[model samples]
Target: MARVRANPQFCSSKNEWKMKNNNERTAAVLGLGMMGATLAKLLLAAGYEVTVWNRNKDKSALLAEAGATVADSPGAAVNAGQVIVMCVHDYAAATSILSQTEQSGWKGKVLVQLTSGSPAEAEQQEQWAEALGARYLDGAIQAAPQQMGREDTPLFLSGKNAAWDQALPVLKVFAGSPEWLGIPAGLASSVDLATLSGIYGTMMGFFHGARIMEHAGFPVDKYAALLSGILGTFGEFIQLEGQLVHQNRFEKSESPMSISVDATARILRQAQESGIHDKFPRYVAGAFREAADKGLANEELAAMIKVLRG
Candidate 1:
């Protein structure tokens, strides 16, 4: 079994660590899924010596054609790189791959896990990595596979400060802006999940809106075009809402809870009348009404945070 005998040490200071040459910085990508393949390609484009390994040998062939060294096994891949990135399906799959690899090869390696998982799972993975004397960084990729090498690709990362510093150079190659959340291994996952929650909520609203418009004999494409205009202003609204929630001052209102509740009630009625599924509208109306019932009727729409907290 291959084992990493020495940890890749870097200065604790924030100053950038210089490599003897770009080729000296090696990275190994464990999975060759869409996102993982894109990442490996980005590293290769950045001139890093990249080693790739996938469960299916055929998957690594494409990367090899692009100048990546294909490893025969996970242990060989781990041994070939200083920075090891895993983009497997989930925390379980990631651990399973690692378990099969020579355990000793983990020492002194920096393991960047971009697997989708809960915060608790990230923490567990961090502990497991630490036990093996490996530095672990939990990360979440905020962009799609096609956006991997773009300058705007955002990667949320959390881990020990020293380890983060050590891994920054290789990480910067893939992410245009790699945000360091904190030392807690689970922070990146938590933030990622929170961000996803808001995105999914907005998507559900759009889906419901589209369904309602279709039921009303309206052009769905036209509705989508009109919605795009309104969606552009959501960023400003979100900023204001965040400020209000942070300050615990939801009194001043652009749109009060009562008004939103009433508006949502109308939406529920429309869905019901059109014989369309009202589940999404009903769920939203319930939250708005709950806020109003809590005596926050005059408060801004941001006051719904109270109901959410409960």
Candidate 2:
């Protein structure tokens, strides 16, 4: 069974003895890109003995100045710390870096991958780490570099339960309360892709809306403000729609398919009349048109999922 641990109200415990030993205070950060650099800085700020390394030696300068030990190689960095955090470009880059480290260096080390990749890649890395006798945890950071270490930062993680327990202290330094999705090793990546899909879809609509404001001689900033103001309410609506889809309840609801059909068609017509780009509106309108044709016009808006499922 998959073990899921998620508590919205959960906060990182401040009990220092949880990581009492000097070894627990030590950490290694590989890859000094924007996000990786931020992670190393956060560890240093939290009184951790941070050892950092990067392909470009120049990237380690700032960290070295901030009291971080700059390792000459990945293996040296891994050997210097009990917990190893890697946040490189991709799985390929990560693998290339790890290849330089000897298997003996990885043995019994807690390796945390904050690199973003597909679920398959995550599973592959986990297998490789386990073969080297390392405890591996795959994580996906949902926020930008500037947003790291905040109480609300959402970091999705998945791995063995033992690894989760061992790395909890180190993980808490990066995220106030990192969410442990399960032990599949790919749950973090899967959730990351799912959330990104929703985010990008919303961004498309926002971009199209911005065009509408520009064409109508209204300030785009005002439209952006409108979006920001309604995020909470809109999120709630999205949650309800998600529930409807999950339950397969397509009966008449607060928002029916007929309403979306009319709204989308009107938006598309307005875009055409204004001589603006109608691609986004046209696509959405087409989907609703198909749903209507399929006799789901009176069903809930989430019934549109059926159209997609086909």
Would you give me the overall lDDT of model 2? 0.88
For each candidate in turn, the TM-score is: 0.91, 0.91
Q: After superposition, how far is residue 151 of candidate 1 from its true place, in Å?
A: 1.8
Report, for all candidates in order, the number of backbone clashes.
2, 0
Model 2 lDDT, residue 39, Cα: 96
Off by over 4 Å in 1: 1-24
Candidate 2 similarity to native, TM-score: 0.91
Per-residue alpha-carbon lDDT of model 2 for 1-310, expressed as tens digits? 1112222222122124225655777889999999999999998778777788999988888777666778888999998888999999999999999999889988888899999999999999999999999999999999999999999999999999988988888888888999998879998999999999999989999999999999888999999998899999989999999999999998987898999999999999999999999999999999999999999999999999999999
How well is each residue in 232-262 modelled by candidate 1, as lDDT tens digits? 7988889889999999988866777888889
User: Per-candidate RMSD vs. true structure?
Assistant: 6.0, 7.6
lDDT of 2 at 234: 88
